[model samples]
Target: MTAFTAWQVWGRFVVNDSPSWTEPASVLMMGWFILLGSAVGVREGYHLGFDILVVVLPETPRRVLVTISDIAVTGFGGAMAWYGYQLAAGTWNNVSPALKIPVGISYTPLIVGGVLIVLFSLERILRRLAGLPEPHLEADPADSVA
Candidate 1:
């Protein structure tokens, strides 16, 4: 994506003939990147949330709240997958102006990411039920910059 943006800038400023395809291509790529990145975040328990309340709760209540949260996430993921499929299917015949690719291609990431979220959430619930360690919310020390 960076390379595409750089090429776009260079083409416009240096070559004086910017390609029309670059903008739409970048938009499509960014959509995929965001959706997939969100799925990875869900799997890693890295998604944003307010944990202050949960953190203050007692152990049993915390467990219950976590379970409830996981169930909610699973439901949300399922809904996204279903609606994303409908959207993709509905726009399958529509083509982009510049790339001429089917408009549905841009929505594929949503469906895939939704499915991944569902799978990951289910695994988390299962782990919780099996008495496995709770997923940590702490940021990785390695992510810290000097």
Candidate 2:
């Protein structure tokens, strides 16, 4: 993607004409990067969690809350996958102006990311239930302020 963008800039600045495909191609690349990165974040527990309640709660309730949160995220992932599938199928015929590819290809990342998120979240929940070690989680932001 970086190389493509550089080509775009070079084409515009040096050649006096930007490649028409670059902009749409870059946008598609950005969407894939962001969506897939977020799925990886789920696996790594990099997303923020409001754990103030969990910190103060009793062990039982804390576990309960955590399980519930994971379940909710799983449901959200399902929704994303379902809707994304619909969008992709619905737009499969629409061709990208510059890339000449089906516009639906751009939405495919949503489905991939959603499925990954669902799998990762379920793995966390199962590991928690089985008393396995937790996933890798980022440290709290407040801890670094010193």
Candidate 3:
């Protein structure tokens, strides 16, 4: 995305006319970036949440609430995968005008992100069940995969 954006800028400023594919490519890359980032956020529990209730709850109730929250996230991931599949399938035959790629390819990240979210949420739940430490809201930078 950055490369495309830079190319777009250089083209427009230096060449007077931008490459047609750069804008669309950057937009498509942005969609992928958001989806992938969101899935990783779920894995790291990095997304913002209203934590006042959980913070005030007793340990047991807080655990229960956390479990419920994880369940809800899993459900949301499932919905994303299902709906994304439908959307992608519906648009599979349509090609993007700028990139000449199947438009459906743009939506493929949703399915991937959804699956990742579900997996990560399930891991959290399983860890809780196993009496292991649950994932922290923010992962240690050194502990994260590159």
Candidate 4:
């Protein structure tokens, strides 16, 4: 996201005869996807949860359920990483208009975010197994519900 923004900024600079962007803007843009996913997690406490029945359960069961749910979520991330890589690799030749970069570059976020989700899920699972507190999967009081 930031990369795209930077691209636009650099594009303007190029037009205005200012210094051109030096660093690879795509890398910066890719970071935005990861940041976006993290923001989602932070906003919701966790991104993976069984929200349907959780509201009716007591805290204990709800925590246990969420922990269990995270395992599946992490596995899903793994699957996404695997499939996303294949998809990206398969479409690497296709280019975008603004960036003229490979279409696969956009999917980098999916791969990276999937890995991050897996790591977070593992952390949550370990915390659960170690009897540490499970992280909240709900938004803060002030945040709108997902």
Candidate 2 on 104-146: residue-level lDDT in tens? 9999999999999899889989988998865343245676657
1 against 2, candidate with superior lDDT: 2
1 or 4, greater by TM-score: 1
Candidate 2 has an lDDT of 0.84
Pairs that clash in candidate 2: none
**Candidate ranking (lDDT, best to worst):** 2, 3, 1, 4
Residues 1-146 of candidate 1 have per-residue lDDT tens digits of 78888889999999999988888899888988988888887777765543556666777787787778878888888888889999999999999888899999888888988898899889888987898876484345786678
lDDT of 3 by residue, 45-104 (tens): 765443556656676777788888889889998899888989999999999999999999
Q: Per-residue alpha-carbon lDDT of model 4 for 1-146, expressed as tens digits?
A: 45555665776667653333323454546565564666368334556468867866887898778777887888887887788788789889997655568978767777777777777778777776787754464434676465
Off by over 4 Å in 3: 48-50, 135-146
As a whole number from 0 to 100, the lDDT of residue 86 in candidate 4 is 87
Full-model lDDT, candidate 4? 0.68
Which candidate number maximizes lDDT? Answer: 2
Stretches of candidate 1 off by over 4 Å are 48-50, 135-146
What's the TM-score of each model vs. the native?
Answer: 0.87, 0.87, 0.86, 0.60
TM-score of 4: 0.60
How far residue 138's Cα lies from its native spot in candidate 4, in Å, is 10
